[model samples]
Target: MADILTVNGGSPLVGDLEVRGAKNLVSKAMVAALLAEGPCRLRNVPEISDVKIVSGLLELHGVKIDSTDRDGELLLDPTNVEQAHVADIDAHAGSSRVPVLLCGPLLHRLGEAFIPDLGGCRIGERPINYHLDVLRQFGADVQKRPEGLRLTAPDGLKGTRIQLPYPSVGATEQVLLTAVRAQGVTELRNAAVEPEILDLIAVLQKMGAIISVETDRVIKIEGVDRLGGYDHRAIPDRIEAGSWACAALATRGDVYVRGAQQLAMMPFLNVFRKIGGDFDVDDEGIRFWHAGGTLNSLVLETDVHPGFMTDWQQPLVVALTQTTGLSIVHETVYENRLGFTEALGEMGAVVQLYRECLGGSPCRFGRANFRHSAVISGPTPLRGAEITVPDLRGGFSYLIAALAAEGQSKVHGIELIYRGYERFSEKLDALGADYQVG
Candidate 1:
């Protein structure tokens, strides 16, 4: 049976919620522990299902995971890392594509890595072609079988220069994780410089991997002989922090998000303030609220770091439903992202999806037949409705929509939301959100 969230709308989600390490970074960081020569310690980890998924995957590969005395900390000992059984890996893989990342690190240690067929959310087609291509460049032989893929480094992995057509985060991480222990220098052009990626680099650096980032999105890595485990705290989840801020704006409530860093969220903060929302940033975190006025409609675009994040678009779109005039959002990251707006339209929001890129710039999806842009006409009052969650980010947006709606909303498939948001139900309860799980 699908888990349904019954949300009583019209009440503002108020009060304080704490965010932990990033969902994007923590999982990949856990995967990186496999490359370590010694025990590793990661701090500020979030208690999300992805962490558990990665933890189980690591244990299957014989990495010992233990808890530390400090809260939100994990000790990963990869000293006895071994190849996991194919059947065992397939059973414990869950729905994350993180196992694909095991190719590089496992190859370095065990000389061969077995990758199960990857799975993720239904947001868009995230082909592992980029990852496979990167692995091939590193001299790993890829063999496709009925079960999954088997990658063996017969001549040992070696680094080579490659340029990404697009700066895909997964692809970039694949290169980093693989290239760190490869035999030679690796130069990657058009690399993704997201904060999560940088934090992973920081972890890798502490593990004795030498990586340098150029201003023009080029990253150079000098392959190390071996990598020691790192003692590092993962970055805060900017996506989660921004989602809560948007929830505050959508419900016209005040929210103080602890552990939300200001520097990483500057683009979101700028956009929030521009929409007539208010925020105050301190050493601890940020407080978000409506500015007690009609929210202004604005044209926004989602890009890589230093621009509005694609993950931040969905929830903010919910807030735009209450804004005056029209708001245009161009989603450049994922082509199928605007598909989530249909649920909003059902709830009385005037959100229209367009194949043409509606923001100031034309994106890769402009020529393709995908609805990558959305035009929102609002000050439209939302009514109660039943909505099924599409993906992680989109699922959170549904909750924000339900909270902002006039009556009640039955949100089905809420289990997907737990893949990203940490302690979300309890956080909603702390904010006085009227929601119950069934």
Candidate 2:
């Protein structure tokens, strides 16, 4: 039977809950474990579907991982890394984009690698072309196979100068993971300096990698012949922290998110304050709550790091539904992110989509037909509605909406929420949300 969540609405979520390692960084760190000569120990790992997917993929390639500990530590040993059958790879990689990242390390360790059909959130055309081009630039031979893509380092990978059209996080990770063990030096321009990317760099550096970050989005990596194992703690999930903060604002509740770092969430914090959400940050976590007043509507734009993140847009949109006046949101990161707002509209949010950028300067999607912008006129009441979970962020936003509504709401396909959120149902229960899962 499909998973369903029955949410009882009109309640404030008030309590303390903990957030573990980042879903974005933990998977990549698991992949980075494959590059080390010995076993790598990663701490504070989150219990999410993406981590399981990557664990299965690594196990298929003969990487032995021990994650039996309850304290969220993973000990990954890649001593017996060997080629696995493509069929097994496809089955284990089912609808995950993490396999694409395994190409460079596999090629370096085994002279060849195979990546099955990639799958992830249906937000935009996240083409693997940028990843493939980076691999090709690093002297990898790419060939299309029936099941998936096959990459071979016939001449042994060599580092080279490259530039990104946009600072894509995945492509930046590809360059970092690939160039670390390649020959000579690699200079990358227009790189993504997201906190997750920096955390990955830290993991690699612990494994004896030489990497330097410069001003204006430039990253330089000096290749080493070999790398040792690393022991590191992954960063907290800023996205998850922000999501819960927005939930507090939407339902006029108070929430304390443990392990949420203030530095990584500074941009989100600024925006939260502007929208009339109050937060107190300590060394351990941040406490978010509604300020018990009218929320101020404002123009917002979603960009890469140091900007209002695209991942934070959805939940904030739910909070914006209760704010006075109009709130304009320009999503510059993903083109189809605003589509999730349709369910919000069905639940009585006055949201309008636009093809042209309405809140900020013209982005890459402004001239296109994609509805990447949103205008939400709120102080509107939300009622219960039947909804299906979309992507990870969208799924959590739906939960916030349901909790803020006046009646009962049944959310189906809620298993998608587990892909990124770690034990969120339990967290909801801790927050005193009246809900049952079956």
Error of 2 at 44 (Å): 0.3
- Model 2, residue 314: distance off in Å is 0.8
How do all models score by TM-score? 0.98, 0.99
Poorly placed runs, candidate 1 (over 4 Å): 68-70
Q: Which residue pairs in candidate 1 collide?
A: none
Q: For candidate 1, lDDT tens digit of each residue in 309-408? A: 8999999999999999999999998889889999999999998888887866547888889988889998999999999999999999999999999998
- Model 2 agreement with the true structure over 329-409: per-residue lDDT tens digits: 999989988899999999999999999888655489878899998999989999999999888899999999999999999
Off by over 4 Å in 2: none
Model 1: lDDT to the true structure: 0.92
